[model samples]
Target: MSSILRRIFKGKDQQHQIVIIGLDSAGKTTIVNRLLRSEFIPTTRTLGVNYRTVKYRQIMFSLIDLGGQEIYRNLLWQPSLEKADAIVFVLDSADLRISEASKAFWESIQQNENAPVLFIANKIDLPGARTFDTIVQDLDLTRATRSSRPVGLFRISAKTGENFYDAFDWLADVVVGSESVFKCKLRTVILIDLDSHKIWTTKFSSLKNEILDEFNRSISETMHELMKEPAGMEVIIASDLQLVVVKNHPLVVGLIIGYSDSVVRSKLIAERLMNTASSSIEIGEFSSDVLTKLLKRQWPLDIYKSKPRSD
Candidate 1:
């Protein structure tokens, strides 16, 4: 039965092409680097398109960071949309004419009716940064979404690492959500030791030990290749329940969910889990059964069935 279910739930891990489009000096490359390294690095303007792949959990996000110069801005979105799963439109939040940037953003997405855009309000760490509600009002995002499908805007500071995980988590979930069944309720809360790579999971989980091993190994390998620890509120928005992974030092806590959990839930639970695991465990005292029992005692099955707070 588990094997059959695995076969049924397969094929959502295909490489997804996500292009990062924004104005020149809007911190496009810096945002990608921040996702890669979790810290700000000095960057120059992108002369042409910058291509990089972000391997997160089961998906390889082919992040095409396009050069946003006036000359290159004219290159139309039709060609890019031919293969993309989603559009990630980034804007310079501190720019005085944010509405102008929004206009350009709508213009780009309108050209490709197929791809849903995840609009990012970047550079929020800078002075004069605009608020998310302000951008929505100014950009008329409500109007934009009314005419389109699956559009979302988020306020992110790539420089300071605020709300980056939440945005990326939703982006991945949105992309995968269109393909297969994404658990709208919580599915899995995996506790993996960064040092030993042992896996502990939640109930009714379909992930086999071998499959779980792949996810486990990739965590460290990804961190090594990207020079970024799996820090921040890391969520793997898989095709099933959206996967949220929060890393605290030695222990990484991954939660797979269906609906958008409230901001309070997403941040606090994963954090508290990470803290509990890191602070409680001994070197060789870990096992899947033991952790599962402990998790049930602490979290319980009723917790997973609870409806997530949308507002």
Candidate 2:
């Protein structure tokens, strides 16, 4: 399915920036090398910052590895956080003092609260390394989640490459799809379940956010009226914007497109969304968070011409 989607949106490139920040000797450099270089290579402590770009799903993930020494943390953090789309905070699992110091750096941040943070309990290869659960408790992650940021924790070994792909997968998954690559007239993508009253959406305009809750309610009502057969569409087409819905049992996927968008393209995306929702890991009382992740997979980004990818 991914192969087919790649064929359709093959040329367009979306760029996202990610920065890695942690204390010195916490293996930030090791983690960076593990990702950019196919093989794990011995890494020296970074004096300042290291940068690399990787391509995935037509998006350029610009990774910045910032030096984590105390003297440089203040000077390095603000600028890096300001430009970051996501932040990876690495903690030295075997060193409690380093973990405490890293916490101080994280708490000092006053901006970019919306940027999702993926906390990596790194250096898990050590015999005395703290367990993931222990680190989570010590850091008070429960309190952190109640805050605005989208936070996640993972245990990783930069040396052995354990859970390496899983860690990167988490990063890419959290970084929202770029609007730069979307063709004009594509408005929004929404996912909902019939068995549960929950919805997730990625909208193209601010006006959509104002009307989304009410629009969603109307859609539910319209579905009951028009979907007598248990599977179909209920649309609202205005002069400027239009809506298209596709459904399979227990689930419905809708696309709010500008009237100018290609009918062929819109229909293809709707079908893709429906198929994915139907085959999703689970249904009934499904999570909007999980659905949001799935919805992004079907977003259409048309690559126009061959060139170097830039962020």
Candidate 3:
């Protein structure tokens, strides 16, 4: 009975309705505040629906935050879901009422089948926060999967801003019909010298040693090829793995990223890492500990400085 009007404006700019829903005290409003202001803003329980239009990466998101209380949810959830281009379900990662939240989530999405879903386990910075795997199991998301719709599950802390942009980046990509550029996960980082000899390398996520060795060899080969030119950057995809080789004169930094898609987002991340490396360490003079410190500094979440972990 209800329909969402997706509007297209100028070049590469469009508007989509995004409905944010969850149980009370699930940090829905806080997430919206972070998106709108890009800062931590505390908010109270929503009594009704709050609407705002936010532009992110040239896309206007008509964010409709529906009140999560039982009364308001019974009264307003259907209409909001009916008109949503994407549905964001926020869950309190530390909350004990996950069953209640799960029931509410399933009930809310029953009527909507086409809208993409982004499941965010919020408050990951808090103590006793559930891990991403645990939360996914708790929500029964694995069993109640929607193959027709694209679904993204991410663990994030809106307070500390950890993995915040990564989640939104996926949402933005999916909403715009661009598959997923941000899904490229940082797997391994290799710092090579002008002679193509490895100065230092580290793997983030767990991988088989053989696979890691293969990736290293591929990266080394690519590094050698790039060292021939001694300038510019190149991205190489080996099946699912992505290698971003940057030649900065005396140093060539190779980043092995998982889930090879495109070169744009991964290259930007690699370039930023290069910038950090350039400022933090001198070429051919830093120890592995120093490089490790640099990486931990650059991506606190990836290395996991605290208790929260993103998957």
- Weakest 10 consecutive residues of candidate 1 by summed lDDT: 178-187
lDDT scores for all predictions?
0.67, 0.65, 0.74
Per-residue C-alpha lDDT of model 1 across residues 1-311, encoded as one tens digit per residue: 59877775565446789978877888889888865655578898788888898754355688888888777777734567556788888888888866668767877887777787888888887888888788888888888777657887788888766788667767767777744223234455677776776667764445555545655565555455322554655444333334556666666676655434432355566676666566456746656667666666666643555544332
True-structure RMSD, every candidate = 8.8, 16.5, 15.0
CA displacement after TM-score superposition, residue 206 of candidate 2 (Å): 44
TM-score per prediction, in order, is 0.61, 0.52, 0.60
**How close to the true structure is residue 78 of candidate 2, measured as C-alpha lDDT?**
81
lDDT-best of 2 and 3: 3
Q: Give the per-residue lDDT digits (tens) of candidate 3, residues 1-311.
A: 22332322343455799999999888989988887766689898788999988865456799999998889988899988988899999999999998999999888777588899999999998998988888888788985565679888888888866667667778888897764444455667777656435477766777667777777777756655676674655545455555666667767777766532333465566667666666445554566676767777766544442232233
Ranking by lDDT: 3, 1, 2
| Candidate 1: pairs in clash | 182-240, 183-240, 183-241, 183-258, 184-258, 236-243
Off by over 4 Å in 1: 1-13, 76-78, 178-268, 271-294, 298-311
Descending-TM-score candidate ranking: 1, 3, 2
C-alpha lDDT of candidate 1 relative to the true structure: 0.67
TM-score of 1: 0.61
